[model samples]
Target chain A: MSAVMAESCLTRNEWICGEYLRTRSEELTDATVEHVTITLVAIALALLVAFPLALLARRWRLAAGPILSLTTVLYTVPSLAMYALLLPVFGISVSVVVCGLVLYSLTILVRNIMTGLDSVPDEAREAARGMGYGCARLLFGVELPLALPSLMAGVRIATVSAVSLTTVGAIVDHGGLGNLIYTGMDSYFKAQVLTASVLCVLLAIAADVLLLGAQRLLTPWTRAGRRAGRRRTAGIPRDSVMDAPGTVV
Target chain B: MGVLPDTWTWLTTAEHWSGDGGVWARLSEHLYLTGVCLALACAIALPLAMWLGHGGGRRFGGALAINISNAGRAVPTFAVLVLLSLGPLGDHGDLPTIVALVLFAVPPLLTNAYVGLSEADKDVVEAARGMGMSRRQLLARVEVPLAFPLIMTGVRTAAVQVVATATLAALAAGGGLGRIITAGFATYDTAQVVAGAVVVAVLALLVEGVLALAQRLFDPGHHRRRALAAAPATAVPARTAP
Candidate 1:
């Protein structure tokens, strides 16, 4: 059975080597879209869980160690093992992929978010409390903005890795570039595999750059010094306060 | 409960532990792939990173090399494996899988080593130099020992990741515990898949635990307080903005 499959795949080498993408533009586009959707959804879901968890850890200092270690354990579970663990429960689909990717993102996301919040000036927090700002208002109006760079750094790491990780979901028939990769591997279709793999890599790089752009746009004070100069009075004496958050996590 | 008993049954079966695709075979294959890939990555990345860290003149160049290598993380190991197996590397044996895993391991190895050496205490380095030490002596006697903890942390991180990711070798027709999962999937055996996953997870944790112990035993600067501070950051690729 394996020999026959390899032989059949070998037969497609001519067109696969020459005009693979042109011949299969539709498949490529669909896979690309699926890849993007999986990545975006996973990061979004990770953020939703990570934000509150990070805040909880911040509010209760003792909770930080256990929570971070739990996420680290989650992060350490290999991606393939993670998928298998999820598959029995979630069934073979996008949910399994998303759940696993979100789990992987949590360690970085929570750590960065916590770090960001930790870097908030104690004086600033006291001032916010003195001004009668509630917890929610203080978090959103002051703490979150100051925390933007670290949070965005985490988001960038999560987003880029999630893009690459989406390819692993092909086993569960999630219909992404991974599908093309696995199919190409099974059938030995060189062009199909190369195209899909390259696109997966490119997608990860592109997602990273896009997130960097979003970070720059959202945190304009990092780029514009006047706003930074103003914030310096109320900010923690940290060096990265004025820099872009593109630091690799 | 159903899955656990079924997984135990699958694991306990003598046949499952023998043959070309048996548990023992797959476990050894997984280890071989991880061992070779990690060795190659260390060979290639360690010297280069050490040189860059020790030289310290072209800080920009060293940072660039580290960053470019780290970008390797963004490229999924699976994609790289598929590309190599189906493309120029040829869909043959474990060559492509080795190449892909090695590439995946390099970034962390390179980054941590570079950061560890370059970030060594300036006072210590200056004192070494003042004591009539050559550059090599300083690196060998002072900097490398000082930097050992972070360097080993990088190795631990890479080893665990490689062990986990090398499971993909089975997808590319290479050998590993992943074959069990892949074969299980082929046969529609969820129990087998669950068992395979359990084995892989256990293997990963075991390797991680062993490395953690090895690090503590060999680390020159193994203060409990510093270890506590460094543990979380080292566990992940923490390039938090300084």
Candidate 2:
């Protein structure tokens, strides 16, 4: 298939079928996997840092402002410049790419985590405390669960941004789908470019859909509300269990 | 010891400021290119956003717009430049570069416009309708004015983004401040690169400041305040109905 595609690419002035197939089958799969892995690692690192910082920020408002502002400044620094600055210190390796990616993720992740923590209803915390729940137990059992949806939304945004920005890594001789894009540009191969572009879009959409589904699954109470509403409108007898608003604890 | 040629030499040289390759001449071309691209983006995105915001259609279209914008945000400016240059439009002067920048500029403009128009006070829109204003009139007279501030935020963002991204036009052999950056990169001239980066950043800041002023000036609430303060002094009845 690769040989055939190479032949067709040579013969055709426009993008050829075999070349498209070969590029997608041979080059794209490995590159996309690598990109996805790198992005996921970066997001994981961001979450590790951001979640604790968010908890700290919640405890200390003054700290949150400066930290968030610093992240915002980092966000404005252009992607290429960030990569260029890092290259000298970290070299053109996955470490530098990950550093840039993690730094970029901080702005989104911190905002998301802080908002999630702030949004946890005060009444829920009071009820949990009334039930004699400890801080660690309350946070894990109540607050984090309640804030999961918002936190996931932030993760969704961060993940998509990471996926896109990782393409800049291609400039530093790193291998990824961005390599295909850069190659297509350098060689003026439209099919290669379009195929890679389409793949990136698809990857973003797929990731979003999966995250959304996970959010829905983790927050069954929201779904339960819709179901209960439907049952009430249909004149079904509401069970006392369903009638009671579940306490956070 | 020096990075490259002196900055003043490049700036003051008459030959460098003349004809096709002159610095001033190139700057003018860059401005024209940037202006045309931004105008085209705003023109296309503004109406689309207004219509979408007005709830003329299902949100599926809005979702599509959001997705496309996200994609646009994801793709690096240089990557887009290269793709456009190679596809259909090859490195042929300003057209491809403009197209790329327009793509870059459109998303934020469209998203903000749609959000702003849609979020305008429903009561005000209803009042405008009660006054027997047509849909077009309501949009033109009420919605657009009210939404202008938020729309300007999008425009401000797009301006900064376009100006910064426009520097990539140099990669396509299109003349712009990017030419200096790319040239500097090629010749290993750190000063030239720094100069280009400085000028582009300054231009971005200036554009941002102008847009910020425009936002402040067009804020409907600001006008309302002035009107309230001036009301007692004027003999004419203030028109505050709708």
Best by TM-score: 1
- Mark the 10 consecutive residues where model 1 chain B has the least summed lDDT: B233-242
TM-score of chain B of 2: 0.83
Per-residue lDDT over B164-231 for candidate 2, one digit per residue giving the tens place of the 0 to 100 score: 56765665566776676556556755555545555555565567678789889878777787788877
What's the TM-score of each model vs. the native?
0.87, 0.78
Angstrom error of the Cα, residue B68, model 2: value is 4.3
True contacts kept of 2: 0.15
Off by over 4 Å in 2: A1-7, A23-26, A226-249, B1-32, B55-79, B168-206, B223-242
Interface RMSD of 1: 4.8
Q: Which lDDT tens digits does candidate 1 get at residues B1-242?
A: 48778999999999999998899999998998889989999998889778788875445645555565537667777867766776657645677888878877877777778767877899999999999999899999999998897788778888987887788777777789998998888898999998999899899888888989999888876686576886766565643321
Q: TM-score chain B for all models.
A: 0.88, 0.83
lDDT of 2 at B229: 82
* Deviating ranges (above 4 Å) for candidate 1: A1-18, A225-249, B56-60, B223-242
**After TM-score superposition, what is the CA distance of residue A99 in candidate 2 from its true location, in Å?**
2.5
Candidate 1: CAPRI quality band? acceptable
- For model 1, name the residue pairs that clash: none
True contacts kept of 1: 0.62
